[model samples]
Target: MADHRAQDKLAFLLSLVPYLVDHDRVSVAEVAAHFGVPQSQIRDAVRLIGVSGIPGETAQYQHGDLFDINWDDFELNDQIVLTNRVAIDDSPRFSAREAAALIAGLQYLSALPEHADRAAVASLMAKLSRGASAVPSSLTVEATATDGTLALIRESVSTGVQIEFCYRSAQGEAQSRRVDPLRIESFDADWYLRGWDHLRQGVRTFRLDRISEPVITTEPITFRAQDVTLPETLFEGSPEDLLVTIDVVPSAAPLLADYIPAGAVTTEIGGLFRTTIRVSHYHGLKRLLASMSGMATVVEPAEARTAVAEWAAAGAARYR
Candidate 1:
């Protein structure tokens, strides 16, 4: 605790000199009040500054080597004034690593839906590149899927082509499907591919991470991006969206965004995130809970938990 206090005192003193230099001429009382310290502490800082400066080439402190202050004004009126000021650094630059980090962040911002100025972000990145003292290592922000899956989806969307991929369904079944690439959207850290499915014969949403063996076919898209009307939310709703409230782990909450209505409020209870989400029926909810395992538990509408229990018993009976 004492060492921490000493460190804090050193930081305060280091900052005090810069503030005093910026003000040029300030009262001891004013400095103390500004720093939220007592008047004595301010006077002590002034005395400390009086003796602090860079050493000359000679191993001894020369006349100008030490900071000088007006003693009369300090003694009589408690006014603080620096007669000798050391050189201050004004042109500070970010390190190569720091510049690279910032440039990477700017690149990500440019890709966001709300960020409109790509040129501006590019200009800033160029400035950072030049201002860096050393060449930064080539670093970039990659999409949520890094195995060339997102790139293929992007190619399909841009070229107006249908993409074929083996999509892993909610029931852990993989089926070969072709989708007319409509739009690629991101929710939080996860990315979703919304397109017209040839097999389902309707618009379907697929999680990019679950899509595998993606290939862009030579066939052109039946429906273009501008022609289709996408829902404000990624998933289209029907009269069958059964609202089943559940207590899910906080980390898994974003995965349920498709089921969570836009206006529904989620609350935290008993160290779990409590939110209501829509499912087609109780059987589907039971399956979802089974997949999640212990990551989530049903919290309300008692039938939801009962549905899960019944499904488990029925599965066990088959084995028996």
Candidate 2:
């Protein structure tokens, strides 16, 4: 509570400094009434302002009656008038970390639907992206969820009601599951609903994209007072990390690096660019390779090589 009060006081003080800088002079009694603080507190705030000056403006501005502060200048009507103050346009300058966070947030926003906020997001991204020290990376991806689905999920989870949704697995297989939603959270730049699979009797994370149709069940599921934790290990559907070696064109390695996991990365050994990855499904990778216009090859991960072989054979047979 004490911390909260101090934070509130700091925030109020910070807000006042900007107004003072904008207007040059402010009445003490009016300032107090405006902020709903006591007259004594306002006096203390005025005294505190003497110690706070814009950086590099100390030689010109000094503490004096020219601090020119007067408590009785107003009509005692609690209206503070600022006059003869210097304007310091010291808005926050983003550091590299702050800039990266902003870019990531914008990318996350881009993945969502185009709302009124989307225009603001686009404008902000354009402004930041053109900054002198801006990074050469994109954080623009967006996705949309079912209307009112979020509220329904929250209510169902809190009340321990069963939720049935038509979920499309990563393999593009669609099925329905009656789940007791434990928690819904964002991860890896996407939203996930983690819950107990009453049918499977285990925890599962449902990707927002994969959930095509949601149907809430009337049956009340037994709620565990304790929170159900999401699975620590994911992408285990793949049978272990199969060491896949793919030879990619020197120019394409960088582009391919974006699609594969950081750990399973493209490496340059000697003159050749190679990608070593473990994949559960080969279809997506195959399609990506086809789109690359024969710039990439699957050297290892015998499973991927076999799939590619079959794909090639089918193409050859079609031509014949």
Candidate 3:
């Protein structure tokens, strides 16, 4: 079976066939370029379409049901010529659920004042609602607020310019730095700027909300190719990664799920959830444990348990 994402691409490719046929014999390379896909993908799609057709009277694909193509021209000259095909010119209509999902997504995007064209977004939503069999009334998508800092970061990213800004670290230390904006991405409702940090001379991820007084620079990006890839795991552990387990109260189990990676083994015993988490170092682990207050406790790695206790003690000393 084809992957779902590949199936989606195939569906999109099928929709383009009508337009391609209307233009007469089009080059495979031309179609591939227009769709932003590889030439091989276009050839494969055309080949797949050639073998597909409606079932005939025999209940098997035969004669009138089989699509015909100018194989000689296609294979030899890299051209597509549909000799015989069932009329498939019309665009597919969206189902009620599909239309509703699109409307919700568009509604969220439209609310972003920095990026949306209010009038155009409204027109699109109206058209989608008109086509939908049943418009979704219960669905609502709220947008995050936009501010000058976000606008400055976005501008820097779009223009391929470096930016300088004040960043408050997770430990609450403030510092000024310059960075080449690679991309602005959001994970779990928090926006982060992943870029090449000039001060640290490395790739770093900074929370967008932590940035202040951002200044877009005239200076162009100077980061090397090797410095571009963001790590698969953002905060790496010292030496090596460790698998840590924690016993959580049932009430706090839901919160633990958010921090735990997918597929990590979890078990419930006597109303307590034993959840395993992977972390790079004690610093991050301690912080996560601290966030749970007194609802969670380390179950293994005595060192981590001690570290968390010490960390809590240090935090307590500040108030004393």
Candidate 4:
């Protein structure tokens, strides 16, 4: 929390100018309460703001450029009075990436008919684009959840109901499971349903796209305090997970950075980049290696190399 003080102070300063201008005069305690910070912090922020100003004619902080605060009213009494300050009437502008993020989120929200105000979303996106420094022409975000899936998940969340769905695991196995839906979240370009999995007897996060035959059950959700406190990191590597190394071509090497764990060493040997990646499961690794075509090859761990070879051979046989 202490590390975020600089950010908090900047935000306070931006908001303080407008707030002080609107109220004309306000107590230090009132400002602290409104901002949800301690009075001392607010006083410190005010003191900092008083010294902050635009450069004067002489290129120094002169009296005309400095923020004027009524020292008598603030120091003697616990009140604040701003005599003069630069006008901060305009709202803070969003950067290009920030604008893009909001626009993308609005696009996702606009996909759901139940929660969408289509016109408002369109208007806001237009405003964001106009305000952005430079909007990217090629940036795009695909909708992660289908209308039916989103509707059912949202209904279950709102009514505290249990939901049943046929989930296709990463290993390509399908199984029926009932879950008390807690929340729907989007992470890493995918929508996930965080719920209490009845079959596993634990909180699990299921990718929405992998869910099939979803049914909003009549049964009410069974309250579990632990479900609400489930960790955001749903996937964890186990001891059984494979530590497989792959040699990727120079052009494909950079792409592996997104998939490989941080601090994983990569070295270029004979123009091919080699890096080790921990595979949570063989099926997932096989699928990833298959998608890379012949650009990537398993270099070590004879088991993984053999598995990928067999997987590739099978795929080749299908085309032949």
lDDT of 3 at 252: 78
Off by over 4 Å in 4: 1-105, 110-145, 182-191, 219-234, 249-273, 314-320
Best by TM-score: 4
Model 1: how far is 61 from its true place, Å? 31
lDDT by residue (1-320, candidate 2, tens digit) is 99998898788878877655444345666677677888888767666654555434465545432333444554354334433233343345466566667877876544332221455766676556433143545443333554355556655654557888888876789888888776556644467767778877887778766776677788897644266544554433434433567888797776654345556655676667876755556775566567776777888768888988898788889987
TM-scores, one per candidate: 0.46, 0.43, 0.46, 0.49
**Best candidate according to lDDT:** 1
CA lDDT of 28 in candidate 1? 89
lDDT for each candidate structure: 0.79, 0.62, 0.73, 0.76
Could you give me the TM-score of model 4 versus the true structure? Answer: 0.49
Please provide, for model 1 over 147-260, each residue's C-alpha lDDT reduced to its tens digit, 9 standing for 90 to 100. 377667667766667889998866578999999877668765567778888898888888887899999999888876667787778767678677888999999887787788
Task: Judging by lDDT, tell me the better candidate of 1 and 4.
Answer: 1
Candidate structures ordered by lDDT, highest first? 1, 4, 3, 2
Query: Per-residue error at 268 for model 3, in Å?
Result: 12
Per-residue alpha-carbon lDDT of candidate 4 for residues 1-320, written as tens digits (9 for 90 to 100): 87598797788799987777656568999999998889998898889888887876798777878888999999999788877664342357688888888888877776542343477778778767655556634456664446688778667766667889999988789999999876566654567777789898878878888999999998888943343676645454457777889899989776566457658898988889989887867777787776688789888888888887898789889997
Q: Which stretches of candidate 3 lie over 4 Å from their true place?
A: 1-92, 103-148, 223-227, 238-287, 290-296, 299-320
lDDT of 1 at 129: 71
Backbone clash count for every predicted candidate, in the order shown? 0, 15, 1, 0
Q: Which of candidates 1 and 2 reaches a greater TM-score?
A: 1
